[model samples]
Target: MKIRASRISDSILIAVSGEEPDPAHQNISRSRRLLKLIAAFFSLFKLLLTRYRRPEFGSLRRDVWCLDEREYFESFQQKDPDDSARGQGGASQQEQRSQRGKGKGKQTARLEPIGDLGYSGSTFFTTPNGKYLIKSLPRRFEYKFFTRDLLDPYVNHMRAHPHSLLVRITDVVHAPHPTLGGLLGVAPTHHIIMENLLYGRDAEGGRFSNKWETYDLKPNDYFFPERDIADGRLAPKSVKDKLVDEFHDHVRVSAANKRELLRLLEADTQLLADHNAIDYSLFLVRYPGPRASTDDGADDAVPDNVPFVDSDASPWRTGLVDADGKWTYRVVVLDFFWARHTFRAWALTSLVKSFNKVAHKGPMSITANPADYRQRFLKMIQDIVVEV
Candidate 1:
């Protein structure tokens, strides 16, 4: 398999073939190139298809700054009901003027804008205090394209369920413009502000300490370990226990942590059981280390066996300043557009790898004691599966 970088998008197009054709053979060379081109085009097409297949709440543009942080905050303040200048209700002229001044005062502590904070459509911004993360949607897309009535019910279910890991929703803000291009036809721009992951890192961060190293894994590389365990070639007990201990440690150290992840997994299963969503990918992220000073240009090394402090449940609950200033958990729901297919299993598998890497130094050690932890984790996962 060969990967080619695309000039148009951040995604890389892949070309996988059975064997490399002989360069000396003109016909074989031409055929291989053609095949490669076709593969590349198809891969890019598939990504676009995936983007359009779901409702786009924001731009798919690779560049950040599509949504400016200060503008987003200004918009939110303008629309907030509590604001005196809020246009929604009838406020006296004096009240509106007073509120405007107060709102301006509140804006005094604004931080610099964050540009490339997300993996996909949205960009994340934090306040100076690091208590809230603003996920700004694009200003061009239709709101209905991404939102559904199911969201409220789904969120409520997660809140009510003891085992759900879903993040809490605090407030929803409508932007002045649609975040998606050309899709906006009088649809207001919008953003969802909710509980940020308070006490944990993203799934990907947990898997590998180094960013470049994690991307080296082929598709098959991710699945082979589980296959070995299933076939009895790998010890299941050992893996399970290690996973359990790691999860326990992650929760114990994190603040405002709850049994939410387990519950969210269970809720996902139920959603799948009822044919409510589609399977989608999810990942976790961690801060590499303290910011580099002006005098030092070197990347901060993530310490080994360092106990992380999870400050909040999600980034939305915290702010941009909080993310940069402190350690926190931000559980992002990547596949909200296709809620009909739940990717609980894949997520769990990924989580297993992630937690083990961060908690146990590498792949989880499936020793006798580790096996017990493994069983507990498995049980938690199984209970969710059964619920689904």
Candidate 2:
């Protein structure tokens, strides 16, 4: 299979050139807007939810809690709330997304849109400081993901496979059936907070980001980055070659690292399949090389671009560095365990897939059995990982 790496270019000339008018664009935009509204709405709602949802202890998975205003958002230096954002110390109707933490003790969560996100809603954002991701999702999906099928077992699963590539859900601010309703329905809206995978968001994400290279990997079609093929396009064939060439110039890991990555992928995906869930993607990132030594923040990070090489520098290939160096990853196996296929849902998805329409991206990701999911995932990797 030909792996054609795609990129996010503002030049939609690529995506729009031959495409027919898409009604989905409205949905895509509205969904994105709803997503943004949720983020903003929650910034205001946080004032209330925190009162009830503030941090809980004894857990890192599915932990919920509020940033105590006394400790997190309060400060003598805080500006008067805007006229519209009066509640919960929110900016009145006229104020900005996050209150500026400008005073001597003012370290309130300064929020802003890093960019829009999602398949339908482009509604994902991160803190300016590059620490966390905050966004909302449909109530039903959120509920299912954190309960019996996903959240609890995830803890034991991660424990059993310590190196699994699951990004832990750190905290959440859940609204019980908001009066305003979900973007499309009456379902609740959940604000998910987690570690910023890949990189943190600053004000400039729409234009740029801290990420240097990111491959959002899924199972089929072409080892991801499929531009022209995945979506109808007639772009150049050299796209993959250019990207691989670029990857090798900056990153090269050893055999052990490759195996470790594959191991993690298999374990994590199998876990997803075990739960009768699928439709997730693997995000592999290559961090930027450190700035010049003379720069002031040089000491704070891994001095840019230097791949971490362990004792056996085995030349890890595939996705960033090998086992030796700084593990070239900001992995988050995303979009999983939403519907518990229970016995019924899984059976339906499996049965429908059996009729053999185009593959639902990857079937195991949907409802295929765990063993089958794991085997297929690993087999695909074997086919692609060239003697790394």
Candidate 3:
């Protein structure tokens, strides 16, 4: 991973707001503006500098920005109806304050692990203010495939279809180093910054909130070792927990809303299949609706990245309220990194075939062909989303 300095400089330039300064203040503002700019530059530089100060390693500090990501997120935020509600009150105010704090003199915030500790090997960290998630790309092939084959197309698709349910990847940071630690998977050099869809669900800054439940859904028709190995007797609790599906109830929405949701999913999955992507899951979240409020402190803040429509009848547009108004749903397709052509996928497919021959079971989710997987995935979701 070669860290490009020019790209970082360009990113800093792009991050600066494009709004013109007021004409009246321009003459008097130049000196103050220059001083402020210099201070901000140093502040950013200090933040980017790694804390590690090993003399032998020569002050390990490498920060490379994925320039295109900045523009992509800028467009995404502008297009996001939820984000547009910032400063107007409701849940957006918390996120607004979080962003405003980041723009101040210097940032002291750091990334911390979310409570769940995801089943995936990669580490998941959330920003201090819970606005964004930082996910490590420990696997070389997955990250390489994303950057080489899918990045540009994904960005273009999101730009064209801003309301698409695909997860918003805000930034990609590459911190290259000459150490063997990164090569051994001890320290991941590549990471992606994504918008936290479940932000503000939990108590934050003394603000209370209603409970929000989340589910990571995927097709479970095939034999799962966690569930099939003598009812998970042979698997560790952690493994069993990760593979088991706990979401038994259907996504109770009206028939019309279901159709719209499926339509969006069809388009999203088609893009993944077109690129040979597989093993993606629907990350669904739901909370009590207005009538079924569980907490008195519950506010009107919506997921920052999810599109909120103004029409009351439109589930997605109306912030995903259910047909009966019992729950509000937030859904996005995630983990579309594994590809059919990848060596890992091929190995998994081979292993599944060998196991299926002995146990008479179907292929695991990861082993399915892109087209086949898309069909099964859609059908599974279709079964889950039923009329209210």
Top lDDT prediction, candidate number:
3
Each prediction's TM-score versus the true structure: 0.35, 0.53, 0.68
Clashing pairs in 3: 91-301, 309-317
**What range of 10 consecutive residues in model 2 has the weakest lDDT sum?**
1-10
Regions more than 4 Å wrong, model 3 = 1-107, 176-178, 203-210, 294-318
| Per-residue lDDT of candidate 1, residues 1-388 (tens digit) | 0111111111100010011235666555777867754553433211211121111212111111133223222322223334322112233333433554566412212322344332234545443223345454443222342354345455445445523333333334442222232143212134444333422222223442332111110112122343445464565654433221122212122222334444454455454334343322223333433332222334343332333222222322331212233332333343343332224334544666676675443332221122332234335333322111
- lDDT scores in order: 0.32, 0.42, 0.59
In terms of TM-score, which candidate is stronger, 1 or 3?
3
Candidate number of the best TM-score:
3
lDDT of 3 by residue, 1-388 (tens): 1122222222222222222235876677678967755553443222121211122111111111112323322322222334332212222323433554577622222345543345556766664444557676768888888878988777667655656777766556554233343545445556666656665464333232445787888887866767786877887887777773558887788888888888888988999999999889988888766655434333544333333312112235235777766678878888999898899889888988988888877877777888988998899988888996
Estimate the TM-score for candidate 3.
Answer: 0.68
TM-score, predicted candidate 1 vs. hidden true structure: 0.35
Stretches off by above 4 angstroms in model 2 are: 1-58, 61-108, 120-122, 160-162, 182-188, 200-211, 222-252, 288-328, 340-370, 383-388
Candidate 1 Cα outliers beyond 4 Å, as residue runs: 1-99, 102-106, 117-119, 139-146, 176-188, 198-264, 272-275, 279-335, 339-388
1-388: candidate 2 lDDT, tens digit per residue? 0110011110111111112335766566777867755664433222112211232312333222222322122211223435111112433321221222134222333343454444424345443333345555554554555554576677677556544567655545444334343433332245555545543212232222443466655555322223433552444555443322122332234566557667777777777767666555655565433332234344433433332211111122212443334334445566664554555455766675664465444343445555565566566555545433
Error of 3 at 209 (Å): 4.9
Candidate 3 lDDT score at position 295: 43
